[model samples]
Target: MLDLAWRPRAHLDRESIAIHLGLERKAPQAALDAMRRIDDAIERVRTFPDSGGRVRLDALRRTEYRTVLANPYTVYYRFDEKTLTVYRILHQCQNIDTYALVDLPR
Candidate 1:
């Protein structure tokens, strides 16, 4: 089975969990819980890369990229024949077009 690798942006994505949690009035543990869920989802992605929805990008010519939602956040990933690359994690409400992820490494 292929392993899933997180791109640099994915690391920033993970940080967003704490950012969101900090913005909320909820307990600090809630951020930890969200991180745990994202970790679990990443594991699942390693086993099933296509578990995410096929993302259609106008800026890009292909539909190879996909996204999986983890509650208020969405995980964007790309898969080549041999590996899965997690590109970014963004809040669901964010305007995805602003990210310009079409240049992501395949």
Candidate 2:
């Protein structure tokens, strides 16, 4: 399995999602479940790096982005021989355009 690396934005995204679910929506258990699901998706990615569906970005066609769903959220990442780097964790409702993934490493 490749080593895992999380971008700072990805961490922030996760925290934001948890906060929104737990504090804003008053759904602590749902937040916890979402976190668990996200973790499970990450583990799946670690074990099978190519399991995620490819994401197409017009601006960066040369760079491949992949995604794994965690119910209402999605985990976006890229992987190489030695590492799998998670770039973002976003809500399913969000518009996932190039701008939303601007923080991804080139």
**What lDDT does each candidate get?**
0.74, 0.89
lDDT of 2: 0.89
Residues 1-106 of candidate 1: C-alpha lDDT, one tens digit per residue? 5667787778877886777785665657888877877777767777788787887667543657788877777788888777888888777887777354644554
TM-score of each: 0.78, 0.90
- TM-score for candidate 1, please give it: 0.78
TM-score of model 2 (CA atoms)? 0.90
Provide the clashing-pair count of each candidate structure: 0, 0
**Whose lDDT is greatest here?**
2
Q: Which residues of candidate 1, in runs, are more than 4 Å off? A: 22-26, 61-63, 102-106
